[model samples]
Target: MEMVDWNLAVATATRLVRPGPEVSREEARDIVAELRRHAKASEEHVRAFTRMEAANPEDADTPVLVVDRPGWVRANVAGFRELLAPLLGKVEERRASIPGGAVLGAVGGKVTGVEVGMLLSFLASRVLGQYETFAPASRELPGATESGGRLLLVAPNIVHVERELDVDPHDFRMWVCLHEETHRTQFTAVPWLRDHIQMEIQSFLGETEIDPSTLLERLREAAQSLTGAKPEAEEGADAEDEPSGESRGSIVELVQTPAQREILGRLTAVMSLLEGHADYVMDGVGPQVVPSVAEIREKFQKRRATGAGRLDQALRKLLGLDAKLRQYRDGERFVRAVVEEVGMDGFNKVWTSPNTLPTKAEIAKPADWIARVHRKAD
Candidate 1:
């Protein structure tokens, strides 16, 4: 039996997702058309700035879809299904071994579906755009044989953010497209990246050995951490000074074993690199391309720092978005430092192979990556 009612998850998300800002049908069409044009235009700027080109014709022609909040949620649900298949299959095997497992799964699936839907509904509005690496071939554009993945610009969210920030709509849209197009360039330029990340995720999930009984307890602890309730040992301690694994802001951190933590570190480093590089490229390409880039960046940074309300703050921590924000800051610093020390050509060596990728420590200390990767110069 399926562990999650995927169809139900979609329905629930569609029902719960908040409506985007009101706009006339004509205005919406204009926004969508402009976004598609900007996506294509940003590709050239990204390629020129990063000097990373698509590896093949298919990659070069990767599709860009302009979607609303519900469409974005649906696409992500599909991606989650594809990415979690291995782990779900494993869970199903374990469930089969237990008595009354079939009935338990039948009831649990709907509950899990609802939970997943709620999570997606929360995220659907926050995301601006994404390059979906695990997109299935069935969703590929016509005449495309294999899935090179597709870029999705969440139209409503993009419009919402630009309006909220009070920036030039045209400039803001192109700026957002610049960042997202950099991601498309990253995956398409590096032929091995998508598979490498997929393998790493599969390896991590393949090793998961969760006890069904203890799952609730772990979740409780994670919730406590997000709510600022400290354990006895951590009481009166500075949260900033806490060791890596001890600072549990999210359930992702709370449930991980030591081995899983190690894997997570590797994944974190990779994500930091990707996010940071995108920031770096966007800024690098901004001044010439985006006329109001300065104003947008300043306002966006302030918005990120201030965040929304208490409930939103707690939810951001619970979802590990706080850490994601850190990734952009930390990763951008690493990229900027590396590029300053060695030109973009030298930094490009990082894409040569998986072995050359920065470790978690190196992401914080650019000199370390430089020393390790460019030791011959020393």
Candidate 2:
């Protein structure tokens, strides 16, 4: 039984994400060149303020790509496929273990594919730049390497957002690069980070099971609701339970098993650390290199709080994006608070080993991590 047809997912995503106004080959080339110029300075800025024990493992000499919306969707779909490979394999095995499971498996795969495709369709327009630490399989797809563990700057989205914000275009571009390049430097310089995060994700996935019958039931109910067959009163409870517009407490509500929740807690704490550190590094470089940094940050934060339309806002809520946003704010606060009390060197200790990483509670109260970590040192 096939768990998911990744190719079909990619195709559906590509079709759903409407193509932007076409750019000539020359324009695309120029976009990549311009971003590359900014990237060099951005890298230098991050390095000047931060120190890591290990040398960056990534091919720093590699170029960044400037992709359009469809390209972004295709790349991310490939990434999701690679990322979820093991979990889906387990699902397939579990399905086959059941009596008359083949038909159920096929239905599950198709439904999952469509759901993922639709999610990516909306996300394609929102992301700016990413440092994909996990490399895509080179032998599998022709253009996979371009989308692998390298820097990706989505050109159209960047251009559109910058224009809309009325900020300094050059400065804004550099600000964006600072964030992405910091992430690149993070996984590269910390060496163990990539493997550590991948392992945690795998552990989380291992504990997560997809019950075909339960999934089928949910799909039937959803279909009925969409067709307006369900009464309004029946939908009230579901709407009320829909997370009250996103909060820290609701962050792990989607995970089913206790093991998954435990793994998710660890994963969330680590992400908070990584994302917080990146934000700290980006702002630490400050107004000297990125002169309009404050202005850019202010406008960007406002933009995130409110999306383009009701559909975009709804997607963000449904996708737990607000929860993700809170991570940045929460993490930044934790990092700032910790660094204020213990200096940069003391805060750097968190990156030394996974054991030293913050817990969810520690993330909310930075002093707890500082005291515990430093006490061990003494």
Candidate 3:
């Protein structure tokens, strides 16, 4: 029997509850043990958090930091709590007794810990029927997103304004949360989306290849450029019409091939649509929910304009999520404007099925989208 370590536990639990198995039995036993240990760890973390919350040494207004900041996890919990409240009375009356929200209410003020334990328990209970261990309503960020079916989120340990996702950020940060939550909701609602996202990622990896020599050349060029002496070194040289022709070439050799780039672009476009739709939906709802939205949005834009390095690295390193971010900003405006003109009922019709989503071109131009919506109205 393999000693269950943390890594093995994550792998084992992940594979056990995952859509498919990607490990061996001996390895799996270790994973199972690790999962239990991790759950205990999570519980400990929660207890620590509780102590942190209780100590009250720090400012109450101090911002909170999360290791795993999965959009769906936060959103689902918030949404479920909201969902659970109103229905609680009726349910209790029907049962004639339900222990006053036993597990749930006891878990209050310690929601995060309870939720972590819930996920671990859920993961372990796969021997039973298919119950969502982590659903749209419950998602978490991982130290690594490579694990299959594992919903993961991560953000900086430091943030401006607030923690716990409540501190205001000109609205953009809130919108980000909303967008992330939207992703969670879609996964939870669609059921197929979670599988689809992972499958697409696997497909992308299956085809992706990184060139060694080209990568080295590109690195050298990038390093050289950092010196910032290109113009002075080539002062007497001919005017360089092409921009970074040499460096681009080097990077090109090292990076994904054209065919692979296309694959990447396609994935980026899909992610963009996902992101854009989330933004759009939030816009539709936020005006009614959070008022300082537009100002917050402007602030968020400024952060991006200033080059959010963390965001950039994340997007660049992972399946070109950078492109997705850009596309989303553009797409949000396109979709929101359309919704305003088209009406909610009209726009809602689009999500009737998967095929109805706006294409890449459509996202680029809202006017075209409006025209299509008009045609639909007709």
Candidate 4:
């Protein structure tokens, strides 16, 4: 059981991600200042909405962390490393007992780390901001001490996307902040939420396989997909094309074990609820505050739907981001339906406890959830 050097993992990810367009000191300062300004406004708006939506009132005192793409990669790398360490350790322990497994185990962590770094780098380029509530280890670090359970806005990526979409940059930036702030309020107001989500993640990781064969197979398939010719149907396929990767490779589809399935089902339900609620809040926060909110949402969604190059599309499909897009849509629908039927306060029952969350089936059939949640009270 060779120990994985988490430091090496972060270093590898940092190197691969590198830094995006260089921001001058003045530019950096301005970016931070603008995000901070929006952060405050977003907090106020989101906090008010969250209270109305969930019947929970709360506030986050921690200042937002405005960073660049590279900075995001670094922070995520650290977070992921800490979160996955226990599972990696367990893998190492199992491998040590197997013949010839020790040698592979020694290098396995490094390889996994590299893979993680690569993935995070890709995501960092796309994610505008995140409310990171899962990294307790990150909180111990100097700069991250006060960052736990706080909002993190990637200033550069937000700017880059706004420019690419040719939308109102200020409006777009504030919109992004609004979304993140909604998440911040969700976790802050529901103190148990952070722990619950973290626990689900840990349980899922406990069931995950850190086997070399599994990773190797995925890498080989990725290579093949990258090098393979596109089918005629896919030649001009839009970016919103359905994912082409095999379902077996998808984490969402890999819940075969009974325990894993149970945990996954719960996790999925919680994720759908949270994501849907955030989407609803972000959009429902009113356009008077963000004049271009509608335009921003339309363009942003279109951007996701538009496929990039073959290699890029393949990478996205392999990463299961396609499933994530569905999560957003499905979750949004669930929240909207439940609210329409039961009203905001009734929908708030979901936040009361794990028992009240909608199941996967319930997410698809919002009426079932409404009936169950309401029936119990009756």
**Alpha-carbon runs more than 4 Å astray in model 3:** 1-176, 210-254, 308-324, 345-354, 366-378
lDDT of 3 by residue, 134-179 (tens): 2222233221121112222222211222232344633433444454
Cα shift from native, residue 244, model 1 (Å): 1.7
Name every residue pair that clashes in candidate 4. 239-306, 239-307, 240-305
lDDT of 2 by residue, 1-378 (tens): 467766777777888976654668897677677888888778778876776522533355444666777777766776677778898888778878888788877786787678778778888878898876564645432222222366678888887788888898788888888888888777666667778988998888777657756656555654453343454555445544544333222324444478886887888888888788788888888687888889888998899888787666555655567677878888999999998998888888887889899998899999899888988643
Instruction: Score candidate 3 by TM-score against the native.
Output: 0.46
**Which stretches in model 2 have alpha-carbon errors above 4 Å?**
21-27, 53-59, 97-100, 137-148, 217-252, 376-378
Report the lDDT tens digits of candidate 1 across residue range 298-366. Answer: 999999887678888888878888889989999999999999999999999999999999999999999
Candidate that scores best on TM-score = 1
- Candidate 4: which stretches are off by over 4 Å? 1-3, 18-24, 52-59, 98-103, 137-147, 209-258, 376-378
Give the Cα error of residue 1 in candidate 4, in Å: 7.7
Instruction: Give candidate 2's error at residue 231 in angstroms.
Output: 12
Candidate 2 local Cα displacement, residue 79, angstroms = 2.2
Worst 10 residues of 4 by lDDT: 138-147
As for lDDT, the candidate ahead, 3 or 4, is 4
lDDT of 4 by residue, 205-286 (tens): 7877666688565556565455653445566555455453333334345334667778877777788777778888889885
Candidate 3 lDDT trough over 10 residues, lowest sum: 125-134
